[model samples]
Target: MSASAAAAETPAATPAREPILSVNNIEVVYDDVILVLRGVSLDVPEGDIVTLLGPNGAGKTTTLKAISGLLRTENGEVTRGEVRFMGENIANMAPEQIVRRGIFQVMEGRRIVEDMTVIENLRLGAYTRKDGAAAVKRDLEMVLDYFPRLRERTGLAGYLSGGEQQMLAIGRAMMARPKLILLDEPSMGLAPLLVKEVFHIVRKLNKELGMTTLLVEQNAKMALGAASYGYIMESGKVVMDGTQADLLDNEDVKEFYLGGGGEHRKSFKNLKSYKRRKRWI
Candidate 1:
């Protein structure tokens, strides 16, 4: 082989960036008896979007709650392991303390205050910040620019559409200027086009604001598209983790998450053989 061809075949070395958020070997239990997360571990590198993808009951939401210190609110607790953010152990901290530490979670449903106006809802997100009115005003302007549709909706949050509420949830999270955003189910109930638009904004935030995100989504295909790294969870465990290319090329991920695209195995033996081959699960 030619020297140039050999050099091309050799992979380039990558420099490692520090994790903004780390959930290591965590086990979350609720009401002291019901265990939800089992030895879950994942990392969100600075300035990159890392997605946590799984089925409905795979403990994705629980993991986010555990990291953000919201678990304690619902009689949930991190029974084992540690959740560290910006190099500090935050597993035992309160939710408000966690928010003050630059990590905010946009909850699965658009949990805006129904009685409050849209701008009032956005201002609530900055409750943790010690910034002056000028800084808060600037951040509000930035969020409005990102979600132009929100520019006019000063009415009550209950009056907004489902898609608009999702947008408001994200914009509210951004108002905190969080270093790491735990985004849960951003594409939950929106139309296909709206999902596309939300993911577009997600990518834009990462690229423009230098934001780091840990996204939890059942929409694996859409999540993977926005993510640089992906983790697949099942039955409260991380069964597989890899880069976007690694995940997108996996036949199991394609069949299960992205929807199958090719012919099925011909026999039970073939199926059994392929199951064995799917070591990632």
Candidate 2:
């Protein structure tokens, strides 16, 4: 064989690229004294679902705000580390600039304009865009295609169902063509059926549309099931970080977060008793 043919048969190895979004050692403080996040770090690669799981007051929401530059009003500051997007530090960028940089946040509560028409609300999402009218129109149609209920009610948002409102919120975020979307409790305050629908849409967006997501959810089981990887936070600190299956099978996680069977609770109590007896001895 010729040397050129031999060289052509050899494969070239390349190092993996960094994640699209990186939150490195971020600490947030509100009111100048009330600290919310303590060195929270997370990474979201392209086309993956990363969930932040925690009970209330775990600094999940605050982490999202820090990434979007919306923490300043609450007197919260990064204070320590930086948030990097596409290899650029965005900790000091303005919120508008952050959106332009392809990071969009769908805040808690769905936050859709109650009185505006569905189209109006969607239009507001694209206010940042200047060109590509035809492309924007095509994207809007595509969003409606994913959310057909929104298309049926495109003339009215105030009268839509809870599920429709959630759909609109997500569709609105899509209008901006974001590279990574920060979703804060998309299933909160929804019926079980509606929650399933919302999660289905989230999964579809991540899998079918190739959108990277950072999800903060109180519903631990559902979040872990949908996520590629998960971080469990407690009192502003990450207590565990692992694959979904690892976290699901963890004894401590099942006892505390998953609310496993009564047998699991009894086992925890027995373990505690054993520890106490050993200490006494």
- Give me the candidate number with maximum lDDT: 1
- Using TM-score as the measure, the top candidate is 1
Return the clash pairs for model 2, or none: none
What are the TM-scores, per candidate, against the unseen true structure? 0.91, 0.87
Q: After superposition, how far is residue 82 of candidate 1 from its true place, in Å?
A: 0.6
Tens-place lDDT per residue, model 2, 87-181, is: 99998577899999999999898889988998888877887877678978988889889988787785568788877888899999999888999
lDDT by candidate, in order shown: 0.85, 0.80
Q: After superposition, how far is residue 263 of candidate 1 from its true place, in Å?
A: 5.3
lDDT of 2: 0.80
Residue 255 lDDT (model 1): 74
Where does candidate 1 stray beyond 4 Å?
1-15, 262-281
Error of 1 at 248 (Å): 0.5
Model 1, residue 207: what's the lDDT?
76
